[model samples]
Target: MFFFFVGGVEQQVRQVLKYGAGRCITCGSKADLVEYEKVLKAFFVPVWRWPGKEQLLHCNDCNLFFPPQLSADRTTTAVADQPDVLRCRFCKEAVEPEFRFCPFCGSSLS
Candidate 1:
């Protein structure tokens, strides 16, 4: 008989230190400064957890966690004010005017 274990360590937000702390480098959305923890799972059950040493910027929209120093300081309002770019109606993500599809959400832009 052969058996396999589906288990791994995952990093997750432990606490939000500050909301709207910065912008995500990838998504340009509001990111929170947060403390994080590493959780070890065995057979999909959490077995142990440990707090991370440094705080990071977490984007809820993109589910990305990045270093605070790497985060951008720009606000979403500034991104929305650009008149040259077209935005998707469903995701509101900016798309090129020539694109017939939203790259972010895969929605038809026509």
Candidate 2:
């Protein structure tokens, strides 16, 4: 007798709740708040699907779905308080104002 099983679970964005709601933790790009669903697949075909418990942030550039609390740009108000800090246009990470290069993304600040 032979038995084989090939199945896995994956999360998918069900709907976008808000656009540009946050920043991606992995890629430092804009992320959207979205409702999500979990799907169970068998033999590459979806067998079951259920709604997720809460909304999450979805990065369009990287196709990553993550918790809202895990976003890199969680402290928007804090950044606004610090005027001397410069943000990298490429990665959106804060950099020292005097630095000519972004330490996070190696991009030219000048």
Candidate 3:
């Protein structure tokens, strides 16, 4: 008898609690508050899903996950000084100056 099995956990964004305007502690790029769902996949088919709260800071650039409470101070002033930073339409992350693509979300700046 022979059997093949493939399984892994995947995270899916369920809703955006806040746009990616704040800085991420790990990546130093824009982060967002998102409600996510963790899905367990078996053989490329989703078998189980667990919904998460909307208090996580998701960094699109480095794909890092962290709690928002860790960087509460930085988020309050992330975009206050940078007036030239552009917000990504696709991900709504604040893109730094001179970046053609959003470092956080990889969206086109132009």
Best by lDDT: 2
Q: Write the per-residue lDDT of candidate 2 for residues 5-46, one digit (tens) a residue.
A: 999999999999999998876667889999999999999999
lDDT of 3 by residue, 3-106 (tens): 98899998877777899746676556788888888999999999999997556878888777777775464333655666676766555556666789877545
In angstroms, the error of model 3 at 61 is 1.2
**Cα deviation in Å at residue 81, candidate 3?**
19
Superposed on all Cα atoms, the candidates' RMSDs to the truth, in angstroms, are 5.0, 5.8, 8.1
Tens digit of per-residue lDDT, candidate 1, span 6-97? 99998999999999998776667889999999999999999999999899999999898888876643338887688677777655677778
Off by over 4 Å in 1: 74-110
| lDDT: worst 10-residue window of model 2 | 70-79
Compared with the true structure, the alpha-carbon lDDT of candidate 2 equals 0.84
Q: Looking at candidate 3, what is the lDDT of residue 97? A: 64
The TM-score leader among the candidates is 2
Superior by lDDT: candidate 2 or candidate 3: 2
Q: Which residue segments of model 3 deviate by more than 4 Å?
A: 74-110
